[model samples]
Target: MIIGTAGHVDHGKTALVKALTGVDTDRLAEEKRRGITIDLGYAYAGDLGFIDVPGHERFVHTMLAGASGIDTALLVVALPEGIRPQTREHLQILSLLGIEHGVVALTKADLATDRVADVTVQMNELLSATPLAGAPMIPVAAPTGQGIEALRAALLASVPAARGSGGHPRLAVDRAFTLSGAGLIVTGTLVSGRIAVEDRLVLSPSGLELRVRGLHAQNQPADHAVAGQRVALNITGPRLSRDMVTRGDWVLHPAIHAPTDKIDARITLLPDFRLGPDSVRGPDSFRRMAPGAHALRQDAEVHLHLGAAHVMARVSLLDTDRLEPGGDALVRLTLRQRIGALARDRIVLRDTGATRTIGGGMLLDPFPPRRGRRTPPRLAQLAALEAADPIAALTGLLSVPPGWTDAAAFLRARNVGADEQLDFGSFVRAGGLFLLANTFDRVRDSIVAVLGAHHRAAQELPGLQAERLRMALPDRPPVAGFRGILDRLLDQGVIAQDGPWLRLPAHRISLSPQDERIWAAVMPLIAGERFRPPRVRDLAQALKLPEAAMRMTLKRLQRMGKVTEVAPDHFFLRETMAEMAAIAAATADADGLLTAAALRDRLDNGRKVAIQILEFFDRIGVTRRSGDVRRMKPDWPRLFGGGG
Candidate 1:
């Protein structure tokens, strides 16, 4: 487990660490001369890794960088000072990051021996509402061996067991440097998954692939490292240098390659934060404004800290126009630069000046929907996401009807199981749209119901057109998703597709006795007038049938491929249209160009009939029309079954 040190400046945090581990964490000359921690420092106690962070207000960003992967916090307080401003601020930060397990060390016990009882009362009041409210407080002094062993024992008992690396490997680099013998080394807590020697890992946001040359767990060389352990890795790859990999960068598995610039989160503003227009007017105005008068209004610019990365972002409130102090709301953070993030990752939000941490929250969706911000459906979805696990949240967002998402987005945002039991292709169909297994089943059932109704209503028709079938469904999937469902159903022999229509596998068009009599009369008339077919009115008059009945009969024939409608009032037999196509192919020149007059002369037809036929050819991609002349398309031979 990684133990992080949190406290104010000159609180004997570094001195207390030396007493327990026998190693000094302040390695910088500036820090030693100044008598304060400057940057992040590390020390080890057996299997426990101590991340000793700076206690100064200015180095809070650096402190946050180290706090991202810590399992427990060692909150240090000076007995003489009791609870300082930095101490309270650090506690709030630890609470924001959700660090629950910790031990509060009351340092300088030797000097404040007579004040110990009073300081303990103050410490309890300070931590009453924080994450470490009930944590044990031990007094220790570095100069003398006072309560040092007790502090150590309290830490060991309070720190939880290390979690196993069950997901993809991700190590956020808090420090990167190069050694003479070791090419490049990156030190950080192994946030998740196991990394072994020679395992290939990619640097996210840069997408550079590198191989692990060596591993060090808790200052000892090891062949493999697991999650929740502070580790150093020697890395090497093409064009790789220590400068390219630095603090705020991530060494992650290749599967997590997508970087997001927007995140949906549930945030709570710190109670002491002011809420009003004066808060955002400027730094001068903010300093002049009353503490409780300022608010974090919508569209306010701020700095977002997640993992080890600090980015500029704008806060867009989802449910409200502004957020009051201590009030919680759903929000969308639009980041200025992309970062590697996932659902449920703890985040801290700081003011634009980066001076103080205003609030923080849990990331609910790393890639949230871009529309319907204030709508009920969108709000409900976001609320559900806040209460769901990573896998459940992913499935819920993907299962929403009628859109495709980036496959990499979903895969990268998932907190677990990229290469485990989840089959991405199974739930997500082609075109990168995610469909849950249950969603696919629901769509399939809807299709079956729509087709069944169509068969009952229009038995004389061959089947419903594919486009019509899609429109008939009450809840339609995305176009590609619908097509994928059709393909699956066809492969399973649950449905049959004929040309451009779909039907049940056993469905076949059959006319009733009355319709069959009407078909017999209509067939003879259409066959005799092959080239110059009668209109609906003329056919109805000749057959002594209603025009509506005649038009319905002609439509069924057209669907059955017995007749073709070339224009609004024109009709032709299938054989006649085929003959005309053959004649056009024979008469056209090398360019496949022909005039309406030439076709009319070839078929002994009027100008009106020739024009209609040419238009029909153009519609089906058989021919291209230029000026008054028509030219067969490049693929006319294949479409018309004619020699080139």
Candidate 2:
């Protein structure tokens, strides 16, 4: 377990850490010379790691980086000074980051022995309002070792058990530098998942892929590390350099490398925010009346600190134009630069001047839509994202308007593997997307209704073409998912495909009387040798008819969905075509690729005829060809009632 120290400057946070562990946290020459931590420092005592952060107001940003992934917080309050401004701010930041357990160390006890009781009361009052309420407060002086053993025991009791490997690894880089012979190395908390030596990772925002050459977990050399540990990785890549990677960048799995520029979140303003001149009047008037009361107004530019990244962003209010001090509301943050963010990632909001932290919140949707952001449906989706359980959140999202959810994107944003075995209950899967079962049924009925309207308007035509029919739907379903719905309808016999057209099962076209006689005479001749039927010229000569008339009749038959034209003037009966498709589906290899020679052997037909049939399947979207090999397409099952 990793423990992060939090409190005011010169409060003995570093000294206490050194008393517990032999290593001094302040490593920088400047830090040692100045006797104050300007950046984050690290120390370890066996399995417990300590992230020592600067306590000064100016270095709060640096403190947040170290505080992001700690299992427990060590609150270091000076006994003589009691609680100070930074002590409060750091505690609030810890609570915002969701640190629920901690131990309080009232340092400088030797000097303030008489004042320890009074300072303890002050600490108790402050702790009562935060997540660390019942935490034990021990007084210790690093110089004299007063209460040192008691403080150590309290800290050990507060450490939570080791965390599980939950998802893909994401390390927010807080420090990056080059070693003389070791190449480039980065150190940060392993936010999630596990990382092993030699694992390939991608540096986000710039998308440079790198390979991990070595690693140290919890200040010890290890071949692998899990989440909730401070890790140092030695990584190398062709385009990589010490300068390319910085404090704000992330090194993560390639699958989790998406960087987003917009975020929808619920932000709460710090009670200390000063009311601006344009602050709106309301129940928060009492707060405005305070000397420094302020409001966070819409379109206000601010500094957004997430992970280790700090970027400028413009806040767009969703539920209100102005947010009073100590008030919370839903809002959208449009960032000036992209950052590697994901759902539930904690964010710190600072004023544009970077003077003080105004507010902070958790990200709901990192990849939010630009339009209709204030709509009720979008708000409902945001509400659903508040659920702590991913499955429950997905259940809520699947029930929202249009009832279509991009399942892959939702899971990916939460660091949940899309291929993981999740029980979605009754939600229907359409390729990588999902829809409510009821919504899918409505889509099915809508498809039938559109076809019925088309059949009424154009009685002479067979039906509507598949693409045109899809375009007519109100939902405008995606191509891959729409094909799945169409296949289900066809399998259930609720819809029928006539050539390239889709229609209700009852729809049919009648041949003219004169054409009817010719079709009757031609049916049996082709049926006798359906696998290798004669061409239009041979059929015309057999019937002693004009070649043009035979071709015209065949083209008319094509429209009626009686036959498929495998090649120019060469046709096969619908039943025969379905049979050939089944043969191809059965003959393909495990990889779904089949060659003309394979199909020819299966059907005992000539190689030329098999090639012609395979080419036809390609044009109709059944198979995709690469050189001599053809692989079945996702919609290969759509044609002829789906043989593949």
Candidate 3:
């Protein structure tokens, strides 16, 4: 398990890590001389390890990059300066990031009296609503080696035994450097995945491919490493250097995973930053940051520092206006800019002015949906993430995008996966094919509904048009998706199709009382003399039907061969098609010859339709040769009449 250190500057964060592991975190010359950590430092202890981050304000951004993947936190407070600015800020960050296991280390206990008990009370109050509420508070003096063993024991106990790390390797590089002999070495806690020697890998954001040259844990070489293990990897590849690889860059399997810039996260603000509307804002905040802003508000604007990139973002809060102390937030951090991120990565946020660490949280989505201040259901959608099970966690995040019909492939494209076992509440039957848990019955119901609508109007009519299907489900998946859904419905005998239309297997059009009115007053005017037929308005008035509804019914009737519509206001019976076909065939050629122009003028059709007809005839050898005034081929009868 990874243990993270947080407190004010010179609070012994480094000393504590070193004392526990006998490894110094002050790798930089400036840090030792300045007597303050300006960069991220690391070390390991028996089984517990840590990331010792800078506590000064300016380096809060650096601290954030180092704050990720820590399962346990050591909130260090110097006894003399108990509960300083960064102290409060770091605790708030830990809370937001969901560091459930932690212990308070009060340094220089000898310098303050037992009255320093007040400090622990203050610290507990700070953690009140956070995951670490009521955790152990230990006072220690590194100089005297006081309470050191107790601190170590607490950490070891806090870190749970490692679970399955047999999947892909996810190495988040918080520290990258070149050893004297080793070309490039990136060090970080192996958060959740594993890696092996000589395994091919890639650095994110740039995706520069490389090979793992070597591996180590706590500065010593290791054959392999697993999740929750603090390990250093010796690597080499093109353009692989400290500059090319910064903190937050992941060393993982090549095609298995990539980074994200826009993400969904759970965040909370620190108690101390004092960020009011007047506070200086960062470039990433879409809107201003006000004072007393304690919660991650829905649609609230903020900045996200992911990996090496910074982005302007909007917040999607879980359920409340404010996250009281330890309360959690289900927020979507929509970035105006792009950054490299992976699912479930942790991040830190700071005030643009003082650059103080305000809060940080774990990213649940690399590309989260944009919900501009929606209803409570949206917030509830995010609240279910705290549960274990990756599949369940993903299913909970399922929501339709604005103007979308379903959400499966969209989720898949973003690398979201569900357990084969979890089911979505909506199904194809409910017009929710994108949901994971939908059953076949739901799919059948959806098909039946569409077919039923068509059958009720006219059993002999074709199903709904493809475009109509698309429009009706403007918010569902896509129409091209219907084929697969229909296939399932057909297999279940829920629906059938005639031509382009759909229907229930046993269903047919059975016109209602309105149909009797239409049939009695119509048909006569349309069965013959289809060309230049009576006006549709006259037909509607004759049938005593509303003009618009009449037109719809007539179109449906005509499609079903109950009536034939020849013009915009005129329709003809299907039976008249034979005579019309003969009229068309007679005009095709004269003296056993045909011309493209003759076909156009005789048919009085547009260029496109005329060309289409002529092309069909030509392809069938109905007109060929004879210097473009085409002679009728032997197949003329077959092409124009028999075959048609």
Candidate 4:
């Protein structure tokens, strides 16, 4: 387990670690000269790793980088100083980061032995409403070996056993340096999974691949290290330099690839959070009022801290425009830079202008739905996601009305367990830039119902066009999203497609009994005319039928592929069009070029009808017209399934 020290500056946090482990964590010359910790320091006691952080106000960002991944905290309070400004801020930061187990040490006991009891009372009162309210307070003096052994025992007893989930390994680099003969060593707490020597790791945000040359756990050489241990990795690779890999970067498994610039989260304002001047009615009144008396207005700018990454962001409250202090609200954070983070990761928010921590929360969705983000349904979905487990949330989001989602985006936003990912692999289907699943029966059923209605309404048509079918659906997804669902349906044999049209797999175009009679009567007249068939008005005149009826019958025949409409007013049997195409190909010269005159003689038809047929060929890509000559396209033979 990793234990981090938190308290005011010069409060003996580093001194306490030195007394317990016999190693001075203050390795910097400036830190030694200034008599204060400026950066994060490290020491080890047997198997327990202690991260000693600077307690100065200016180094809070640096301190947060260390406290982000600790299992427990060692809050040190000086007996002489009691509770100071930084002491309260550090404790609040620890609570915000979700550090539950810790022990508060009243340092400098030798000098203020008489005041230890009084300091302990102040410490208890400070933690009364915080996560560490019931934690044990031990009075210890770093010098002269006073209460040191008891402090060590208390830390060991309070630290929980490390449980490895066997997920992908991720290490947030806190320090990077080049050691003699070692080259490019980075130290950080292993957040999850395990890493062994010679293992390949990828540095995120940079996307550079590196191999682990060596490993150290708690300052001792080791072949492998697991989660919850402070480790140093000796890394070597091409183009690798100490400057390239720095603090706040991540070394993670290659399989973990999702990085995001926006996230949906559930945020809680601290009780002492203060709104800016713009949010208040009067500046004087705001200055006189106590903290936690106001609410965070919409579109407030803040600094966001997740893992070791610090970024500027804007908050958009989803449930309400104003968020009261100590109240929880679902919000969206638009980040200024991309960060490697996943859902359920804890994030701390601070006011941008004041740099004081306002609140912290857990990431709900790293990639939220861009459309309808502020709708009531979307708000409800986010709430459900906040309440569900990772696996359940993933499945629920995939089962949305769209029935498809970007695989990379969905996987990146969810922190799925290794076991759950392995179990649910088959449930997710991949098609056309999306991860599809039939988990939502309603979406599937709706698609089938819509296709059935389309087929029933247009019985004479071959199938419903893709765009038309999309419009008919209740929940109209984007074109790509609709295609993904259609592809899945086609794969399942629930739907069939003919060129640009979609239909039920069992659907077929058959004329009704009444229309079949009309078709039978019109076939002879159309076939007799062949290349120069009668127009709709001429056909109705000859058959003594209504013009609308004649046109409807011809349209049905066209849908059945038994007739072809070469021009606006001309119609021909399918066999005649194929015959005309063969004649046109035969009449071409060695260059495979023909003219209307050549085809007119071959078909023995008028110039107008011949020109119409040639233009029809051009429209279907069967022939290309240049000046006065028509050239046979390469695929002309396949155009009508006939030989040249």
Candidate 5:
């Protein structure tokens, strides 16, 4: 279990830590001069991990960063200083951080006299409304170790048992840097989940995927790390820099968790500041945080502490703009920096103006649904976001791209688990833009709708070519993304094609009225005959129509399935093949030798059309190749109603 220490500067917090671990926590020169814990320091005893934090007012942000991931807190108030400016502020921060399991450490007990009762009473009054209110308050002296053993016992007893859910590893990165001896290293409390050496990882909010090069806990190598334990990690991959990453970053499983920028929270302000302890309002009073406010918005410009990351954000009040002190209200905060914040995570709010403790709230949405500047609906969405099934909630609000999900990363925002829809090898062939299965269905339906409408507009056209319809998609990334999905649809029998042309299998182009007229006249003129049909020029003259109009009619006739071309200038009545069948039957000899000229004699209408039909028959395998002539297949007599 992880525990943190909080108190005023020179309150003997470091001395207490040293007494607890026998290791000096002050690592900075400035801190040694002043003899104060200027930054976060670390130590541990057995399974209980310790985070030593600075109590100086100037180091509150540092304190927050240190205290963020611990399961318990140790509130230290010196016996003589009982409650200084930072003492109350630290208490407020603890309250905002939701540190339910903690002990109140009353240090410098050696200086206490009969006045101890008064100081204790005052401490109790100050802690009344905070998480430490009912905690055991033990007075101890770090120099003489007056109450060290009892303090240790109280710390172990006060903090609850570790979380045993043993799910995936969720590491909130508190410190990350390249180690001189071990390469890349990161440290934080392993909130839940486990990490083994060489396991793959994805750092979230920044979304960098890497592998765990090594692992450690309390400066020693560890085989595997688990939830509720403080851990240090050595990782290697791209984007390994202090600037590339920072505190509050998440060491995600890649299979779980999504990064979000918006969150709806129920903020509560602590009652320790001068902002009228009684007038300290909840998150709902954040809207008045706008610039140039009449009353300085202490809760206005909030330091939103979600997970292990602390970000600045503007708060929108849920109840009222200016809230009464100690009042509670749910509010929405928009962050200025991105981090690994998810729905339902606890968030501590720090008042930027006074740099004091405000309160903590639960994240309603990992990525909140933005609805203009209105606060009510966003609050409602946050409520949904905090539901038991947060992933389902995300799906309800997700606007995913269409097609088979190619990579699992794209569907993270929808909370699609690897075990859910996509696993090892289910190819999502949305062209190259594969998305999740459901996303692909959405794309296919939308494409079909648009294409079907286009089909109806020009019955003479097969369908909107795939290339053409792809242009209509929103933003139109590329057709490659849609390819995998199209193939799936084709296999499902939802779509069909004729050679290179795609169309609904049940669809056949129909002729327009004037085109139908042209078709009827041309049908008989060509009849059981095959030859290059007249040029559009001669045909228009024969039909007394414009050449362009006649040309359009011929194209329309082609779409209507009434004609086919055997040569560049050729056209054939759909019935021409039948006449070729009859002629080939009469002219064939016993040896299957039949002259092209003999077949031409039977049609008599023309040699060109007859030979064309025979050649068409040969191309289709209805007539077999025999020397220079063509012969009907043996089954021709019964199949085509003719005898040899």
Candidate 6:
């Protein structure tokens, strides 16, 4: 369990830590000389690890970096000073970051022995509304060891249970340096997942692969580390140096290495600023703005802090143009550079000048679309993502417009493990895609509706072409996903396919009596030599029929779905086309590529006819061709009857 110290500066936070763990967290000479903490420092007590953060307002960003992954906060408030500005600000920050468990420490009790009771009452009032409302408050003075044992006992009792190691490993690097013998070392809190020696991970925002050579967990040498612990990793990578990594970067599994520049989130604007007892804002700073100036306007530039990294960002209000103080709304943040962020990661927003904390909230969607963000459907999506239950969130997303979600991305964003058990209830899964069962039914019905309309409008045509039918749908799903829907409909006998055309299974066309007579003679001639059907000129010569007449009759047969035009003047029977497709499918290599010569060898047909057959498949989306090879497409099984 990790415990982080939070309170105002010069409040004996560092001194109290020394009394508890006997390790001075302020290791830098500058910090020692200045009697302040400039960066994060760590100390350990048995199973408990404490992150001692700076209490000064200017180093709040650094403090936030250390506080992000702590399980319990050790709120430090000096007795005589009561609750200072940094104390209140840090409390608000801890609340925004979702810290639930904590213990309050009233430091400097020796100097203000008479005021301890009054300060304790004030602390209780402040804690009454936050997550740690009923937590215990202890007074301690490090100089005289007053109440030191009581505070230590309180901290030990506040440690949360060990979290399950069922997520991908993600260590938010707050410190990076190189040792003479170790090469490179990065240390931070293991927020989730697990890591072990020899495990390969990626350093995000840089895309460098790292191999963990050694590690320490909670100041103890260990072979493996789990979530909710302070972890230091000695790693090596190609072209890797300490400079390539920084405090804000992430060392995580490659599967979770997505760096995004734009995010959709739920934000709460902090109410009008109230100057604390000891005001720190400079004279020129806008500590006192006009009545409504604090309202955040649309496209307002601000500083965003996540983990230990801070960058400039522009806020685009989704629900309102001007968000009044203390108001809540959905928003979009466009960052100046990509950050390794994920869903539910807490973020803080500061003024453009980076002087004052404006507001903060939880991130919803890290890879939000660039446009249509303000639409009603998108707002619904944001609301769905806010749900704590994964199933509830997925249901909301799959029930909205364009009712489908990428299954892998959804699970990854939620940090759900592959082994986690979740009951999605009723849904349709096509590879990595997921959709509501009702949505799948609607899409299937839409496909039949589109084909029925096309068949009714054009009685002479066999059916609507596959690509045209796909474009006609309201929810234009990707080609691979659309094919899955078609396969389902075809299997249920709700729809039929002919070459690359789709139609209702009941739809059919009748041939004219005179045209039927021409088709009767042409059918046998083509069917006799199925694999290598004769061209129009050869058929016309054999029947002593007019060349134009033979061509017209075959063209009419083609429209009726009886034959397919393999070339300009050549055609094949419908059954013969299915047979050839099966042959090509069987002859193709593992990568799905087949040479024309290979097809010729399988069919025992001449090379010219083989090329023509393959070319015909290419035009109908059954296969794609390169210089001398053709690869069967995902829709190959749907070419004749429908299965793929």
- Highest TM-score: give the candidate number: 6
What are the lDDT scores of the predictions, listed in order?
Answer: 0.81, 0.85, 0.64, 0.79, 0.67, 0.85
* Winner of 2 and 6 under TM-score: 6
lDDT of 6 at 152: 82
Model 3 residue 19 lDDT score: 74
Q: What is the TM-score of each candidate against the true structure?
A: 0.75, 0.81, 0.66, 0.76, 0.64, 0.87
| Better-scoring candidate (TM-score), 4 or 5 | 4
Candidate 4 segments whose C-alpha is farther than 4 A from its true place: 237-239, 275-293, 395-408, 417-439, 477-493, 511-644
lDDT of 1 by residue, 130-191 (tens): 88898998888888989998988898898686686778999989999889988899999888
Assess the local accuracy of residue 17 in candidate 4 as a C-alpha lDDT between 0 and 100. Answer: 93
Which window of 10 residues has the lowest lDDT sum in candidate 6?
273-282
lDDT (Cα) of model 5? 0.67
The local distance difference test score of model 4 is: 0.79
Clashes of each: 6, 5, 26, 0, 35, 0
lDDT of 6 by residue, 1-644 (tens): 89899999999889988998999999999999999998999999898888999999999889988988889999999898999989888988888888888999888888898988898889899888788898898888998998999988888888777777877999999999889988899999898899999999999889999999999999899999998889999999987888899889999998888899998999887775322222223343223223226477777667788988788787888988778878888999988899999898999887765556778899999888777999999999999999978888889988898898888788878887776677865778864578898888888878878888888898888897767898999888877677777777777888877766788878888888977887788789888989988899999998888999888988988887888888899899988998999999999999889999999999999999999999888888778999899988875776677565
The residue-by-residue lDDT of candidate 4 on 443-478, one tens digit each, is 568878987876678776767656677787777666
